[model samples]
Target: MNIEVNSQNLKFLECFASDTRIKIIELLNERPMNIKDLAESLGFSSAIVTKHVQKLEEAFIITTESVPSTRGRQKICHLTLESATLQFRAKKQDDQNRYAVSIPIGQYSAYDVKPTCGLASDTKIIGMVDDPRYFSDPEHVKACHLWFGSGFIEYRIPNYLVGKQSVRSLSISLEICSEAPHYNENWPSDLTFYINDTCLGAWTCPGDFGAVKGVYTPSWWKLGTQHGLLKQITVDSEGSYIDGIRISDRTVQDLAIHYGDDIRFRISAPETAAHSGGLSMFGKQFGNYDQDIQVYVAY
Candidate 1:
């Protein structure tokens, strides 16, 4: 059978094509950095470094998050994969084809949010901070992005697969990072994913994002939190994968999802987490990537 990554695979190669971004990667190989440090090290303007970093992130090469700084929020860029390579040939007879769909960040069917939390659309805040009451506002459906310090949010993935829906595999993609009362470069959070109540696995997000402008972020948003790393969580008979890399033994059969059933995707920052850093999510109208939470079903 054939294989593919979460985002466009070529997008990763495109990131290496840039000389400036290569330098950034090289530096990160030595240590992670914030925008200010990268700018200073590269002798480039903060704006310029931000652009290059975004390109690397779009391709899933590097990830950025915000942390506490004397000047306020600071962004730390970390290297994801040291190096990645690919091969392209002809599609095999057993090659599997798939269908895809996208959901906005704010359109969750249910939510249990807490203080140090709030929601924002592409253009404005959904409601006042720390007020779960506003999460029910009909306007929330229009939100392109949202954030919360603690708790979990769940979205209903619409049933759209038609024909022989063998449902060989299922996947969800989103831009996300750890959340905190305020940005902290060193902050860590254990982010967990669940499908139909089955705990797939947990990924640690270093910190919340802020301090720079997201590529598609609205000007109305202050100069903090551009976006988070674009990631894909997938499940199949083969088990689970994070950005195409195996993370656990949990598989599609574990969830027992069928074509007629509604697929629920939930992200949680439970109290027992080692970090409890919180979480922040981005939508199409926000973040460097111009896509929302994407769901892919391969049969």
Candidate 2:
């Protein structure tokens, strides 16, 4: 996340002013917690913790959801923003040499999935849950969220390079995580990436997060994965990177992409992987980030 030094962003800056909120952020960094848990840990009353939580939520630093509990419904809180950058100066505005494409999560051209798989749109589930056949349903194209126990999904993206345009780097950003029954914070999945057919290596997502509802997740979505970590995978002339850390030696040149070429991207969590935990993808209306599979090409 990026923030500018302006009055419009004062609320976000103010979130860090209080020591109580700072402590709340610290505890949430370890794991998601409810208001009662936070209160107990901070030696404060639930009402005080709730007030602090409201402030954090308003700042878009955290998310909360009410879920069933032994007593009744309790509000669980989850940390949302992983990191933020405070920009002190303006940078050059240049976008002519670059182009971006946003592919809906459900617009995959090919797929092979196992049970515990399903798709959902912003309004409703497309078909029966845990049914792989539904992946081929016509309504699949409108899905904003998708998951499977194992296997792969493939998307064919258009290469927008015009005459004389080449490539510098390709960055694909999406919201993804491991898939488990309902939710789990510790399930790890080794999700591999392939461009065209070349392997760009794999990333291990930590878990299926449902500790709290996603900020944009519909209220009707209950008892399931609520959110995922926003990850950016970039392939440059040097190598492939997840977020900003190098993940493999695969380079953009290796893709051999050209004008009018087809960019077939694949995400797989094969059963043969060490973790084999499964995969889940969240789209604009389902995850914290209001975006689909964002593909940015710098030429």
TM-scores, in order shown? Answer: 0.74, 0.81
Lowest lDDT 10-residue stretch of candidate 2: 85-94
Taken over the whole model, the C-alpha lDDT of each candidate is: 0.78, 0.89
Off by over 4 Å in 1: 1-21, 27-97, 161-164
Query: Residues 5-94, candidate 2, lDDT per residue (tens digit)?
Result: 779898889999999999999999998899999999999999999999999999889988788999999998988987666766833336
Candidate of highest lDDT: 2
lDDT of 2: 0.89
Candidate number with greatest TM-score: 2
State residue 80's C-alpha deviation in candidate 1, in Å: 11
